[model samples]
Target: HMTVISAREELVAFYERRGYRRTGVLTPFPYDDERFGLPQRPGLAFELLIKPLV
Candidate 1:
C-alpha cells in the first residue's frame, strides 16, 4: 500500500502502470505543517493506493 498526492495525476498513472490501484481512500493533507509540505491551496489530500498479490 502507498499514498500519492491526489493532485498528481502523473504519479497516479505511473503507479497504476506498476499495478497499483486507487483504494478510494482520501486522507486530509496536513496543512500548515511543514512535515508534509506547504499547501499553496486548500482541499489537498493524500490518496491511498494498493497493489494486490496473486
Candidate 2:
C-alpha cells in the first residue's frame, strides 16, 4: 500500500516523519485541460509516497 501528497517540500517532510517516504513524482497530469470542469491551479501535481506496513 502507498500514499502520496502533491504539496510543498515541508509537507513531504511532515509525511516523512509519519513513516512515509518520497518515492517519486507522478509523470502524467492533465494540468492543461480541465477535468470535471474544475479550475486549474499551479503546483497541482501528484507525488508518490510509500510506507511499509510491518
Best by lDDT: 1
Error (Å) of candidate 1 at residue 49 is 0.2
* Model 2: pairs clashing at backbone N, Cα or C within 3 Å: none
Model 1: per-residue lDDT, tens digit, 1-54?
A: 999898999999999999999998999998868987677888889999999997
1-54: candidate 2 lDDT, tens digit per residue = 344446567888888899888877574455666662453555556688888887
> Would you list the C-alpha lDDT of every candidate in the order shown?
0.92, 0.66
Relative to the true structure, candidate 2 reaches a TM of 0.56
Clashes of each: 0, 0
Candidate 1 — which pairs collide? none
The per-residue C-alpha lDDT of model 1 at residue 36 equals 78
Q: What's the TM-score of every candidate structure?
A: 0.88, 0.56
Q: Which regions of candidate 2 are displaced past 4 Å?
A: 1-7, 33-44
Window of ten residues with lowest summed lDDT in model 2: 36-45
